[model samples]
Structure formats: structure tokens, C-alpha cells
Target: MYRYLEQRLAVRIMEFLRQRYPETALPAVVIEQPPKVALGDFAIPLFPFAKPLRSAPLKIAESIRSEIGSIEGIAEFRVAPPGYLNVRIDRAWLALAQALARDHVPKEEATSGKILVEHTSINPNKAAHIGHLRNAVLGDTFVRLLRYAGREVDVQNYIDNTGVQVADVVVGFTHLVKKSRPEIDVLAREPRFDYYCWDLYARVSQWYAQDKQNLQARSETLHAIEAGNNETAAVAETIASAVLRRHLETMERLDIEYDFLPRESEILHLHFWDAAFTKLKSAGVLTYENDGKNKGCWVMRRAGTGKSEGQQAEQALVQESGGERVLEEEDQKVIVRSNGTVGYVGKDIAYHMWKFGLLGQDFGYRKFYRYPNQHECWISAIEGEKHHPHFGGVAEVYNVIDARQSEAQSTVIEALRELGHNEAADHYTHFSYEMVALTPRCAAELGYALSEEDKTRPYVEVSGRKGFGVKADDLIDQLIVSAKSEVDSRHPELGDEERRSIARQIAVGALRYFMLKYTKQSVIAFDFKDALSFEGETGPYAQYAVVRANGIFNKAALDADEFARNVANKIPAEEFSQFLNGEATDEIWELWLSSSKTSYVVNQCIATTEPAYLAKHAFQLAQLFNAFYHRHPILSEPNEKRKQFLLATVAVVRRELTRTLAVMGITVPPVM
Candidate 1:
């Protein structure tokens, strides 16, 4: 309702302004909420138009207030101090419309084409850690927000099967563990293969530190895997595919789903990089560096440096420091090393080109994994099934990568622009976010041996190479155990299976909400106690509110939908208006007002590319509903009309809260 009225009023005021001042160029009309509800529902400032109209802001506000006769949902317009125009909504009309679940907002026009979201592109080498969870949850929730806002979206999880990370694991099995291809294949088929690899990867890192010569094995293994059709490549594939499956299963515990899994091996086997290389060379996007440490390598200017600008800067450096000091100026990124192996950024550029449908080549698709609901997740292949869903060719693409990859992501976008795919470059979005760290208490609870210095720090950063991080599956299992104990102590009457199911819901909710409650730029310090707490701003708290709302209907033996129908049919608009306008019922009206802003809050979240806003909205809504729940008694009240009105309030709060949590990928269990 707030969004609808805001949009309506903005359009009406804009049209009025253009007619009033025909020669003046008008600015965008922005609608904001007043600080206090008593002031008005919407606030618009006329300061922006003062210079254009050659009039004082106060005079402009008065002119708008007097001439802008009436807006549909607005009851009165007042000229506040300075240049503000405040609008009071028709409270009774809004209350009645909301009670009936009637939305007067017009449908938004659909975006031009499909939006491809790439996230959770973890290296297929080890078990996913807490850092990976933050990436996946943020990406998954953003996808949900886009879908909720009526956009066509495709979710992708890129598999780096041929990267150095996988090569290290391959080295660990072959060299450190002395396992053959057959032995590794057998081990990959066993349970907890990713966990085994996790430890082996850490061992390999230590092995390299012991002797620098041991690093040669990693290079050789990486080359063999990229060349494919060999024993080493087969072993890498077996391990990567198995670990990738484990990753999907872990994410599935949180109800995260993907539509495609594009593998790097397929990118090599299908000649994606080769095709992209041809385009880059033809467009002069790549240059051969003949000297100064990058001899024999093909390079490109870094993201913000254009070709001419780079040349001018290098010339200036040469003039200032002479030719001998030129080696110190490192302004170019090597696309192909002197050894002729393509860098990660090169392949990433090719992959992004494919994402935007600019790469004429396509990948072969085959079904790789299936969820319990039978939603098949497809993967790229050399020779795939004949009939498969089209995977690429999107109008826009968003890569949910970590902030550390900002440079590489920017290079990809710059390459697109240089190649003259300007529109595609403009639509490219790098959803960068900071990493997650464990609080000292959380690290201690995970049984890690923390040094005294580490314990005193605010957060303890985990290193995958050191095998010092909490695995995703391990964390999920622990959360479920904690939640189950809480459930057992509180609801012993429920059966074991039912209690376990509810516990799973609560655990997943807590984990996902903890991941999403912070802004993308804010680093999350994961703590088990804070996430599971039921009294404060946590997922279980919101879940408990929904549960309590449900209990109200359960005890009264009344259907929530039927109660809403009763309010809409039995109560008069004037009576609801009087009830809503009464000073004694301000808190009740505030609950309804908060409930009405779910869509408004969703739009805010989408516009900002941040799910934290929605998380805050859900928490605030829960707080308001809890306050209303305690202050007003529904079933025990003797006033029939007031009781029904109260029930109607509960029904709306329950529905909106449930929907909001679902958008964050959090579920409200029947017994939280």
C-alpha cells in the first residue's frame, strides 16, 4: 500500500509540475516517508525546483499544496516548514484494502531479457567452508528477490575443476598419499570424500612449504588436467565431480538450488577459451609484451587503464626514471603466461562472454544432479544429451564473487567494453562481498586450538590451506543438534520425527539469517549462540513470532483466511477508520502499517542489491507483531468487533512475516 500510494503521488505531482512550468526542466520526483507518522505518510521536498522555477522553496510548496487538488489515496496535503509537502493517507481506505488483500499497484514492466546469476562457484577441491556459505546464501537470496520481483532468472554454479586448487588435491593423493588413479577413484566414491580431500589439501600446502621443488608437481599436474584425455585428468575429474556433488548436497540442506553447473574442463574441451581468444586477438584486446619481465606473454591493460592512457603513463615513467627502471612499472595483466598457460582471468573473460551470449560458441548440456522435487540441474559436457534446456544467452549477468576478485571481475567487464559489446558491459554486475570470519567463541566451540593472541582478537580468520575452518556440513549438523536439544526441552509432546523436522527448519533458518543480516560490505563474525538465540534479533525470534501467531488461530479453532474474510465482509469502512484513528490504538495501527510495507521493503532491497534490508524489515515486523500480540488479547476479549479486528491483524502479520522470511530463504516451522 505504501509503494502504491508513493508511485501514484509521484506521477500525479510530476504531471502537475510539467504543466505548471512548461519551459523548465523538471527533476525526478522522489517520495520519502516522514520521520513521524503524525506528520504524514509521504514527504516530498520542493527545494530541488527552487532554482529552476526562480521562486523560493516555501512559495513552491504553497503553490503545489494549493493547486495539486487531490490524489486518490491521499486525504490531505499540508505545506510543512521550508519546502516540504506532506501527505496524509486515507487510513480507513488503506486498512480496508489491506484487510481484503487487494493490491491497487499496477504491474511493473518486465525486464528486457533473462538475468543470469552466477554464485557459489567454489573450487571443486575441498569441503565448502563458512566463507563459501556467506557467498551462497547472499546469491541465493538475491535470486529469490529477483524472482519475487517478476524477473526471469537462471542460477548457475561454476565449477573450477581444472584450477590449481584441484591440482593441489590431485598432487596430495598421488605424491603425499601415494594413491594411484584406481585407488583415488575408489576413495572418491566413499562417504565424506570432500572431507578427506580437505585434509589432504592442507597437507599439500605444508608439503610445498617443506621443499620448493615439490611445487613443480602441482604445475605438471595442472598442465596434465588441462590437456585432458590422460590418467591425471581422469583422476582430477573423478575427485572434482564427487566433491561437487557433496557441495550441492550441503547447499540443498538450506533449500538452495541451481539451474546449471558450468565446468572449467568443459570450457577447455569444448574450446570456449580458444573461441574467445580469436575474438580478443581480432579486436586487438590482447597485446604481446616483448620485454621487461613479461616477455613472450600476451597481456592486456588493467581495468581502469585504457590503451592510450597506458602508453602515456608508461612514457612518462620512462622519462622520469629512465629505461632501466621500466621493469618496476607493472600496469598490465598477463592473459597467457610465458609458459603459454592461460590465466584464470582469461578463462573468466570467456565465461562471461558466454554468459551474455556474445560468445558465438555454446556448451553441450547434460543432466548432472536432481533435487528431491525432480528439478534437474544440468552441467556442461563435450557430448551431451540431444534435448536439454538452453543454458546461456542472457541479457544481463551478475557474478556473486568475493571482493578479492574485484580486479578480475572488472577486467572481464572492461574486456567486454573493449570488444564493443557496450550494452552487455553495462548490464554486467559484480556482486562483491566481504568474507566471513568466526568469532573467537565460535572458533573455540568448534574445537579449534586458538592461540591466546587469536582469542583476544574480535574475529579469527580461517585458512582453508591450513585446514582451520568449519566445514559447511559440519556447521549445519551442529546447528541442527543445538536446535533439536532446544526443541526437545520445550516440546516433548511431539514425536521424535516431527521434532527433528522442526529442528532442521529452525537450524537452516538460523544459519541463513545469520549470513544475510549484515550488509554485503560488512564482514560477518559467525557466532552460534547469537544466531540461535530466540529473544533478540535472530531468525528463531522471528520464527517464534510466526509460531505464536499460528497458535492464536489454533487455540481459537478459526481459519486465518476466514477471519480476514469476516473483517472485510462484516466490518464497515467507517468503523475501521474510527478504530484505526483512535489515539489508544496507535500501536495496533503501527503493526498494520508495518505489515503493509512488505512489498515496499522488497523493492528497496532489490534496488540496493542488498538482502540485509529485507532481513532488517523482517526483524522489525516481528518486533512490532510481538508488541501487538502482548498488548491485545484476541480470544479472551469480550468485544466481538475488536476481537475480530485483532484476529485480522494477526492474520496479516503472519502472512507477511512468513512471506518475508521465505524471501530470505528462511522457513517458519510449525513449532519453533
Candidate 2:
């Protein structure tokens, strides 16, 4: 309702300006909130109009104030000094209209196409870490925001089942542990098999470092796995599939799910790279470099970097003698090596082509996993079910990768443009974010061996190759234990099962909200003390606000939803306006005002691809409601009309907070 009124007012103001100045070119209508509600609900500067109208800004402000007459939902307009048009909302009409609307759920905007979000592409070799959690949470939150705005979305997790990481893990079980296929299968059935592999993966890295001969096995294992159906391939597939299941479980604890899992093994078996390679050659996207350091390689020009003048002249002379020569190796990205092995970017190009439906091929699909909610997740296969849901061919794509992969991501986009899929390239989004590390205090708490140098730094980086990182599940378990200790103390009378459930909710909320409260570009140093606190700017703070609001109704023996339903008919317009406009009721008015911006903040979040804005808005709303709760005691008040107004304010805040937390993937339990 707030968004509708704002847009409607902007359109009216534009019309008024056009009629008042027939010969002048008009500017876009810009509306911004005033610094304080006491000043005005919205402010529009007339400075831009001054030049166009050939008049002073103060004069234009007065003229717009006089000409823009009688806009709905606007009580009055004022011309402030220094050329500003401050508009006050019609409190009586707006309060009643918003109360009658109940929750102000906006209608979906007209979106034209489906959006594909691929995230949490964890290597299927070991357990997930805190860094991967940041990626999954960001992607999942964005998906929820898109769905709330009524977009068609498909969530995908690309599995690198045939990559070198998985190959090394296979070498571990087969060569180091001397485990047979049946023995490995038994291990997979055991609990925390991914954690076992995580340790073995580090051991494998160490073994290779000890002897140069062990590295040969890694290369051979990678080749066999890529070839498929050999013993090496079978072992790699089992480890990758089991580890993939573990990753899904870790993500599900935070309420994140996917629609599909596209594996690189399927890309190899189905010959997707072969199809993409043909088109690349035909379009000259990849050229053979027969000389220089990249000799006998197929390479694509790097984005935004050009050859030096001397190198270009040398390349021209060399090309006359030999085809495609004299290019700097660093200036080109190798797509196919001299040994006829396709690079990671080569396969990624094909995968993205399939995403935009530009490839003339499709992956065979089968239902591989199902969630508790009964939503089936599909996986790529060589042969599969005939009646399966279609997986790819989306109009837009967002790949949630870390900032370290910027070069590879840019190469994929360049390939798309080179192949004439300009629109797909334009629509493609590399949802890049920085990595997550552990704070010095957190690292010490994890029992990690931090040197004195590390202790002096703000954070300690973790490496999977060295088995130094905290596993995602381990961190989640520790958080639950911590939360359970707090919950047991606060609610000792509650049953064991109920307390455990509440602790899980609080733990998950703390983890997800902590990951979301910062911008994508900000690197978070995870710490428990900051995330678990219930007092300020934490998930528990917001959840506690909702619980307190619920307690108000529980004590008063009133139904919040019922009171909200009857509020429009019960409170007269004059009375509603009087309570809001009264100077004495400033605190309650602030709460009401904060609750109205949920939709506005959501729109801002989607436009900016920044979930931190919405997180901050939720925190601010909780702060305002807490202030209101202390200032006004609704049940103890003598004036019934004023009590009803305060009750309605609580109702709206509860609804908005509930909705905001839901979108953030944070759940509010029955009793927080």
C-alpha cells in the first residue's frame, strides 16, 4: 500500500509539472524519505526543476506546492526553505486503509521470464565449511526475495563429480587405505562419512607432497574418472555422491534447498563439451596457438587485456610464418590443453549454454533426492526417466561463486558474447562474494593451532587442503549445544523435546542471520559471542520481539489476528488520526511507521542484490517496537480507543517481523 501510494503520487506530480511548464523538459520524478517523520513523510527537491523552469528553486517549490493539488493519500504539501516540497501523509485515511488492508502484501510485479540461481557448488570431495555456508545463505535468501516478488525461479547446485578434487579422494581410499568397493560402501553407510573423507583428502594431499611418484596416480585417477565406468570412476562416483548427500543435509538445516544437481560427470558422459567445442571453433571463439608458452593449446583472448604493440607486431610476423603464433601465454585463457583435455572453463561454457537454452542438447534427468517437504530434486544422468521435470533453459542465470573466480566467470561471459548469445551474456550474473574466515577468538575456541602472528591478526584463514577448517555440521552442533544450555536455563519447566526444538530454531536463526547481516563484499569472521546474543542486532533480538508481542495478547486474552481483522471497523478515522498526529504518541507512531516499510525494503533488497538492507530494517523495527513496548502499556491504559491503537501497532509489527524473518530463511518458533 505504501509503494502504491508513493508511485501514484509521483505520477501525479509529473503530470502537474508537465502542465505547468509546457516548453521545458521535465526530469524523472525522484522521491526520498525525510530524515525525520516529524518533518514530513517524504521530501522532493525542486532544485532540478529550477534550471528547467528558468526560475529560482524556492519559486519552483512554491509553484509545485500550489499546482500539485489534492493527490490521494496526501494530507498536505509544504514548501520548505532552500527549495523542497515536503509532503505529509493523510494519517486518518492511510491508517484506516492500511489497517483494512491488514498486512499490505503487494501484488506481484509483471515479470517476463524465469530466473535460474545456481549456488553452493561445493566440491564433492569433503565436508562443507563456513565459507560455503555464506554462499548458500546468500543465494537462498535471494531466491526467496525473487519468489516473494513473483518470479519463476529454479535453484541448482552444480556438482563437480569428475573433478581432480574427487579424483584425489578416490586415490585416498583406493591407494592409501587399500579399501575395496564393498568396504568403501560400508564406510559410506557410516555416519559422518563426509568428515572421514575430509581427513583422508588432507592425507592424500600430504602423501603427494612427500613423493613425486604419488602425483602420477592423481593424474591417472583423474583420467579414469573422466573416462567413466572403470574401478577408479566407480570409487570416485561413490565418494562424490555420498559427500553430495552430506552437503545437502548441512544446507537443509538452514532451510536451504535446491531444484537440481548438475554434475560435470554427466557433462562428460553426454559429450556436452564436444558439442560446445564444435561451435567455438566454427565461431573462432577459441584459436590454436602453435607457438610461445601456450604452444599447441586452444585459447581464448582474456577479457579487458590486450597484447602489447611489440607483441602484436611479432604475432603478425609469426602468423605469416606459422598459424596463430607469438601470443603471450598470460594474455590467453587455455580452453583445451595440448594433451586434449578440456579445461574447467570449457565445460562451464557448455553448462551455461544449456542454462540459456542456447545449446542444442539437454542433459538426461532423474529424481535423485527428495526433501522433507516432498519437493523432488533432479540430477543429470546418461539415461533417465521420460516424464521428468525440465531442468534448464532459463531466461536468466545467477551463479553464486566467490570473488576468486572472477577471471573464470568473465571468460564464460566472453564465450557467450563471442557465440552471439549477447542477451544471455547480459543477463548472466556472477553473484560474487568474499570468503568467510574465523576470528582469532573463534579460531582459538575451535582448538586450532594458531601462531602468535595469527593471534595478532583480525582473523585466521582456513585451508581445506590442510584439514584446518571447521566443518559446517560441527559448527552447527556446537551452536545448538550452546543455545540449548541457554534455553534450558531460561525455560527449565519445558519438556526436553520442546526445548531441543526451540534450541535448534534459535541456532539456525543465529547462523543464517549472521551470514546475512553483512554485504556480500564484506568478509565475515564468524564468532559465536556476537551471533548468539539476545540483546542487540541479532536474530534472537528480532525473535524475542515477536515473542514479547505474542505475550501481550496471551496476557490480555486477545487474538492478534482477530483484533487486526476488526481494527478497521472499531477505530474511527478521526480517532486513528488523533493518536498518530498527537505529539505525545511519538513513540507509537514511530513503530507504526517502521512497520510500513517492509515492502519498500524488500524492493530495495531485490534491486540492489543486497540482503543486508532487509536485515538492518528488521533490526531497526525491533528496536522501535521495543521502545514502544516500554513507553506504552496497552492493557493497563484506561482509554480503550488508545489501547486498541497500541494493540493494533503490536499486531502489525509481529506480522512484519514474522514475514521478514521468513524471507531471511529464519524461522520463529512457537516460543522463542
Global lDDT of each model? 0.88, 0.87
Q: What would the per-residue lDDT of candidate 2 be over residues 370-457, giving only the tens digit for each residue?
A: 9999999999989988989887889989989998898899999999999999999999998988899889998888788888999999
Candidate 1, 1-672: lDDT as tens digits = 778888889999999999999899988997888887777778998889889999988888888889989777688888998789888888778888888877654655454689999999999999999899999999999999988778899999999999899999999998999998888888988878999999999999999999999999999999899999999998999999999999999999999999999999888888888999999999999998777788988898888655477877877877777773353336688999888878889999899889988889899999999999999999999999999999888998988999989998899999999999999999999999998888999889879999999999999888898898889998899889999999999999999999999999999888888899899999778776676565578888899999999999989998876777567887788878877885677677777888888888888887778889998989988999989888877899998887777788898888889989999999988876
Off by over 4 Å in 2: 102-108, 306-328, 450-455
Q: How close is candidate 1 to the true structure, as a TM-score?
A: 0.95
Model 2 — which ten-residue stretch has the worst lDDT? 102-111
State which candidate has the highest lDDT: 1
Which runs of model 1 end up more than 4 angstroms from their true locations?
Answer: 54-56, 104-108, 306-329, 440-457
Error of 2 at 532 (Å): 3.5
Judge candidate 2 at residue 418 and give its lDDT: 95
For every model shown, the clashing-pair count is: 0, 0
